[model samples]
Target: MTVALMWEARAADGRGAELLAWVRRQDLAPAPLRRETFRAPQDRVLVITWWDAPYDAALPELPDPPAESVTRAVHRWRFEAVTDH
Candidate 1:
């Protein structure tokens, strides 16, 4: 089944860009990563990524745990393909 993995993180001042750039360079084998940005009312930066891959193969890589003070949180979501008229 195809799944969509989503990740969100907030960085310190002048760190969001660097963090995003680092993520772009990461080699997420097996499946590719698609990133998007969202604006919060408080101006906090929010980044979301969608990855298409199998549940078993991608779960481990999706929520990559917290990286000390660099990443606040990593979220993941899995969705099954829907086909209907």
Candidate 2:
């Protein structure tokens, strides 16, 4: 089964774009099968990566963003794909 990891962070005031750029530049390991990024109000950025492995598999994950660029702790969630179209 495939698995997806969702990571989110709220950038410090007026730093959303910078945070997203930094994230794009950082090297996340275990190259994902697919990846997507989203941004929202309040400087929130979310990144979801799909991996070719089970949910319980040990997958490489993105490291925490620089403290100065984040307003709150990073949030992460994992999901296993039940079906794919």
Candidate 3:
């Protein structure tokens, strides 16, 4: 079954762009990665990654990085492919 991983994070005060660039540099060879941003009243960012397979099966491991140092909050979601739909 294919899964889509949705990640939402808030960057530190003035480092949103920098953090985003860093994320784009990560090696996502086998799986594909796509990102988008939303402009709400309160500046917020959203990144959606589509994986042909489950996270543990196809996604690459991330390098050492401090969570609190870069993001304020994070969320992940997994979904099954809509084969019949």
Q: Against the true structure, whose TM-score is highest?
A: 2
Better of 1 and 2 by TM-score: 2
Ranking by lDDT: 2, 3, 1
lDDT of 2 by residue, 59-82 (tens): 888889999999989999999878
Per-model tally of clashing residue pairs: 0, 0, 0
Model 3 scores a TM of: 0.58
Worst 10 residues of 3 by lDDT: 35-44
Query: The CA-based lDDT of model 2 is what?
Result: 0.90
Worst 10 residues of 1 by lDDT: 60-69
Q: Could you tell which candidate, 2 or 3, scores higher by lDDT?
A: 2
Model 1 TM-score (2 dp): 0.54
Candidate 3 residue-pair clash tally: 0
| Superposition-based RMSD of candidate 2 using all C-alpha atoms, in angstroms | 1.7
Name the lDDT of candidate 3: 0.55
Model 1 spans with C-alpha error above 4 angstroms: 33-71
